[model samples]
Target: MQAAPPADRRRRRADLLTHIVLILGVLLFALPVWIVLMGSTHDGAAIGRGEVPLLPGAQGLDAYRRAWTEGAVGTTRVPVALMLWNSFVMAMLIALGKIAISLTSAYAVVFFRFPGRMLAFWAIFITLMLPVEVRIFPTFKVVSDLGMVNTYAGLIIPLIASATATLLFRQFFLTIPDEFVEAAKMDGAGPLRFFRDIVLPLSRTNMAALFVILFVYGWNQYLWPLLVTTSADVETIVIGIVKMIGTESNIDWSVVMATTVLALLPPIAVVVLMQRWFVQGLTDTEK
Candidate 1:
């Protein structure tokens, strides 16, 4: 048996310090989740009275039940449930559609030898510099002309083409060896076959990461849905919350917090469930 060298001992000390810092950082991030979960359960009177419940309080379910029913039953308007469905539907469409468009566009640009390829990509890329707000009026006209206003089509169609997703897939595709594409072609595989059989399977990690990112973005979309949907009939959860805040009557902080927590569940679930793929994708890129 031998004792470690002084230099090795110092390295161990540094590693211990690093672990401590990382643990503290994680706790810092987790604190808000803790507060929200606790606060959502407390009644408005209790919460306002500063009687914070560190755990599930006796009245927790009561508050949650009220929030879900919007403080009444058989009202024909469960805004919480309706908004949840709306957000999920819109987010899923945006995620799937964006991935489809990105894969197709990236495959063409990276693997094919086509004329005006750069020009075509550049034209799309240029739009990335401009935020959606800049083009909203024109987009509104298109949606309105198609009679898609206050409809799911209006909510999802305009978000189908994601420049960020395309760029991410393009960069990932570049890292892939060219030999795969050449071999696929040699096997009499056409462009579509090559992409489907070869490229997509290998690009799963990137696609998963991109899907999660796009899903989060779509879930948090407030502006586009707000402007497009004129009535509560079509309002997404984000818009619903904003409307809740602007109600002319007294504000119910407890109900508001409860709704906010419910709204956060989907995005939180998305990140947690896709965490493995997200980490794997980053690791692959590093390699």
Candidate 2:
């Protein structure tokens, strides 16, 4: 082979460095997950004794079965299946509800001129500064007063209004060409018709990306669900996992690790499935 040019050699060296760094980053993140997966396969006693198994164990199936069906021995007998279902339902509702409300809120703010529009936008923007932890008490009282505690409505409703989603949609809406609006008007489309037809189609990528993010946020919610749901029937997986680790005497590390794996899978699956749309939206928004 002919000798490579100096520039080409330097570029190749840079590429190698980049790949090495990327591999290291991947390993850094993946190692913990791998450990958890390995731990979940082993016996609870072995894990409790601080024995970290590097390989998969024969008890993998049994561990998962117990975690899914029976949960931990000393904790509440709520199955992991029920907790997963509650988490799924809560995630879907929060994602869909936030998307719907944010879209409409952004549409009104961006596309229409109304009284107190600035005021309304400011009010919503202000909420971004106040996190769930700050408002937990008042929010809980409100839900309790409404008799929504321990109900699906309590889990879903309070979390549906998201300032971040509204802001994202607002920015995305502002980027849309005015020509589309004029064209829609010339085609005799009304406001709602324009929104439903033109705006929604244009926003599909953004919506998909936001859905993945919001779904994960909802699924990972711990404090809010812990507060709202007193009944085992409405308990989310995150809370159930914590409940699994009973006092020091009864902690089942294998089952807890199995539940951890289960808890992580849905969010990972959501991101993986929406990876294309998510990347596209992010790249497009940067433009």
What is the alpha-carbon lDDT for the whole of candidate 2?
0.92
Could you give candidate 2's per-residue lDDT for residues 63-89 as a string of tens digits? 789989998888887889999999999
TM-score of 1: 0.87
Model 1 C-alpha lDDT versus the unseen true structure? 0.81
Worst 10 residues of 2 by lDDT: 278-287
Collision pairs in model 1: none
CA lDDT of every candidate: 0.81, 0.92
Q: Which stretches of candidate 1 lie over 4 Å from their true place?
A: 1-13, 48-55, 71-77, 285-287
Q: Which stretches of candidate 2 lie over 4 Å from their true place?
A: 1-3, 285-287
Query: How many clashing pairs does model 2 include?
Result: 0
Please, what is the TM-score per model? 0.87, 0.95
- RMSD (CA, Å), candidate 2 to true, equals 1.6
